[model samples]
Target: MIEQGYNFGYLDENTKRMIRRALLKAVALPGYQVPFGSREMPLPYGWGTGGIQLTASVIGPDDTLKVIDQGADDTTNAVSIRRFFHRVTGVATTERTAEATIIQTRHRVPEATLGEHQILVYQVPMPEPLFRLEPRVAETRRMHALADYGLMHVKLYEDIARHGAVTTSYNYPVMVNQRYLMSPSPIPAFDNPKLDRMPALQLFGAGREKRLYAVPPYTPVRSLDFEDHPFVPVRADAACVICGSRASYLDELIVDDGGTRHFVCSDTDYCASRPPLQEDAA
Candidate 1:
């Protein structure tokens, strides 16, 4: 049941219809950014107003929602968004990646493999991959139309010249369907590989930019790189101290004032799903 005064999923029916139309265009075009009438939400712009709007448009009463910030379900952003939906839509919420029907994320994709039943909505601060290189919107759109990503390649080559490799750790540029260059939000390079031919439908929304895009299930997504210097997904060379997970992306935590550090899984749900280490009897 929806809250008393608000429409279902918070947005008005007409607004939802408009957003859905934009989303449809986005999905159809694969990597092209489709402009939409972005609406104001209770939250600020940078804190996922776009994702909230997308979720509001698509989510139904029976859908199970999950929101994660940088892979953690308990972060303030995640918790607040989860509670907001629960309050407004009375929808079921879960921390488990496998259980969620719709997952709205910022900065990181869930470590668990998503299936066809799930939709991954990313909160993008900037939708244009060429924005940093070319500030002019018109020029960027032209470049995208011509499939001219020379600027992006030059930028990457510059990184190699300075740092000895493509050192872009987050928001790495990718070529979608071999046609368009895309910004995969701010997700770390470690998660970039997961975007390639992913089973789940992926959607990106930028509220401040008023842009939306999509990568339909099984669409090809390739990280940009040279033949000699291929795209390599890098992560902390440590296991999760809590779950002893060696494969999941690890977050380094400063443990003490003396600078001692410990590593843990960024995906809290994935970490928790691992079996606890058993101690041998003494």
Candidate 2:
């Protein structure tokens, strides 16, 4: 009953309609972060209100929905979002990456290959790629409109000047279609390759920031890095502790309060779904 008078999911349809309209424009422009009137969801602000709105706009009777956070379908927040869709629209849900037609994700893209018919919706805390360097929303809008990204280049150059490389490890910015710079949400830089020329469509939603953006399937996406110092997506040197896999992003976990920790693949689905190296071992 989030949309009822008791809750209203923290925003009404009029605001959602505004966001929906902006999303259409973003799809048309491809990489342009269109400004919209974002609405609040019953969930926390940093959560997935933007994803919820985008889902509401496009979800139809025939679509199969998937929701993931940190790449695990069972994460509480992801499960909550899946249930929210069930409550609102009663769509079927799946954890299997192959079965989903629309995947709403946070922090990681599914390792499974997404088909051209699928749509990947990212829950974005911030859609502006230049936002960290320049905090003012108004200023960034001007930058996108004019394609003035020299500030971003200078910042990257400054990182090389001091740190010997681009210091950013995740949520790295990329140029979309040689036009607008967009944030790939907080997906590890490992996922950057997936964004490039993918068969599936990619969309970003930032509710708190009031923006929505897109990268058309098979569109170009390049991370900000220099020819001398290229970008790298970090992974654990070791395999997943539970379901051993070397190809997925790992979450470094602390076993004790002392902070002694070991790294494991953050994308549990990817970890679990990989073909076992040795069938006899299983």
Candidate 3:
């Protein structure tokens, strides 16, 4: 049974239409952030209201939804948001990364490679990569319009001078489609490499900022870096203890007062599906 007093996906039909149109514009622009009529969601502004809106606009009855926070499916925010969509839309929900048609994520992309059929919606707190460097909105707009990103280049150069490398580990800026510089959420630099030439369509929504953007399938996304010091994706030195997978991102777990730390895969679905490391019987 559908919930009353709220339309499908908890958004009214008119608002969905407006957002759909805005989404079309966003896709067409391809990395250009487009302003939209951001409606007040039942949830708080910063708590993935933007992603929920985008999910609502795109999801259907048959679509399987997956929500994750920092690459964990069982985390509090991910659980709550998944439940919210299920209650509102009654759509099928799955924790398995491969099973979801539309995956809404915050701060990390899944370790599993997303296919062509899937769409990833990122919850963006700050859509503009230049906001930290330049506070004024009007000036930033002009800079983007003129294809000027000198400030960004200078910042990267300064980082190289101080740290001997481009030290931006997360929320690394990238040039999308060879035009716009975009923030690929707060996903670690490890995940930034997956953003390029991906089969899945990536969309970003910033509710508080009232803006949205996208990266089409197979789009070229190059992380901003200098020629001398090229971009590199850093990962934990240790492999996951349980899964024994070195490729996946890991979370450090401190075990005892002696400060014995163990590493585990941050991606729940990917870790769970992998076979246990074989032990040698001598």
Candidate 4:
């Protein structure tokens, strides 16, 4: 209905129905990656085609939508996604996390607490946690069916042998409900905890990978780690240099030629919402 006036390849209702069916399967299977006939978007595949397609299916006239990339609305990919949605659906848009009914994100999760009414759609590059290790889907599926993940434990042990730590900073693998192994996407391990018992529904989609998965509110997801080394969420020791919020995950920013560094909250809404600190006055 949208593209007849604009250009070409505007997704038809049949395409929307196909995406909706895949979404239903994803929600039912939790972490299981449901294959979908992903349609091409105005934006490139890596940018957020899955997120946009999922958004297209679930959006209603009353929803408030927010889009962010690397914590900024003005980020190039975020702008492109938002423009496509605006042209197609004419949905209301905002930068405030609290005000949004649905949020689509790339590279970071919003730091503010989300409510049951909100939905989080993540743009994922790779949805399989075992892809790096096993490479073959047939083998990985058997491993999952048999509840086998000794290889994951062994990989962590090797990391300790070499790096003195796990060394994995993102795309940390976890067990959903202690039964199904799952990937929490490339968001730092610090953000993994936020997924558990969150008020809003969490959905992960990978366009290039042809996968769509979800984590319902209040579901259990535990990262794979050892008792001696333990799984450490990145930035557990670093506080935001700008907002002074210690709880939020941060992206390291190298500010000087001397290699001096600072940490900034990856959630733009969360950082902007924080009150001015005493350090800011100085």
Which window of ten consecutive residues has the lowest lDDT sum in model 4?
1-10
Error of 4 at 154 (Å): 1.6
Output the lDDT of residue 53, model 2: 80
Query: Where does model 1 exceed 4 Å of error?
Result: 279-282
> Considering every candidate listed, which one attains the maximal lDDT?
1
lDDT of 2 by residue, 93-179 (tens): 888888899999988888887899999999999888887789998898899899999999999899889998777778888988888
* CA deviation > 4 Å runs, candidate 3: 278-282
> Which runs in model 2 stand beyond 4 Å of their true positions?
1-17, 256-260, 275-282
- The lDDT of model 2 is 0.82
- With a 3 Å backbone cut-off (N, CA, C), the pairs that clash in candidate 3 are none
Candidate 1 to truth, TM: 0.97
- Ranking of all predicted structures according to TM-score, beginning with the best and ending with the worst: 1, 3, 4, 2
| lDDT (CA) per prediction | 0.94, 0.82, 0.91, 0.81
For candidate 4, write residues 1-282 as lDDT tens digits: 243363222467888788889888877877777888887776787888888778887887678889999777778888878777777777788889999998999867788889999999999888878888999998988898888988888888898999899878888888887777888878777787888778898888888888888888888888888788777777756778778888887778899999998887788778888975676453
lDDT of 3 by residue, 45-133 (tens): 98998888999999999999999998899999899999999988999999999999999999999998999999999999999999989
Task: Please report, as a residue range, the 10-residue window in candidate 1 with the lowest summed lDDT.
Answer: 273-282
Candidate with more favorable, higher lDDT: 1 or 4: 1
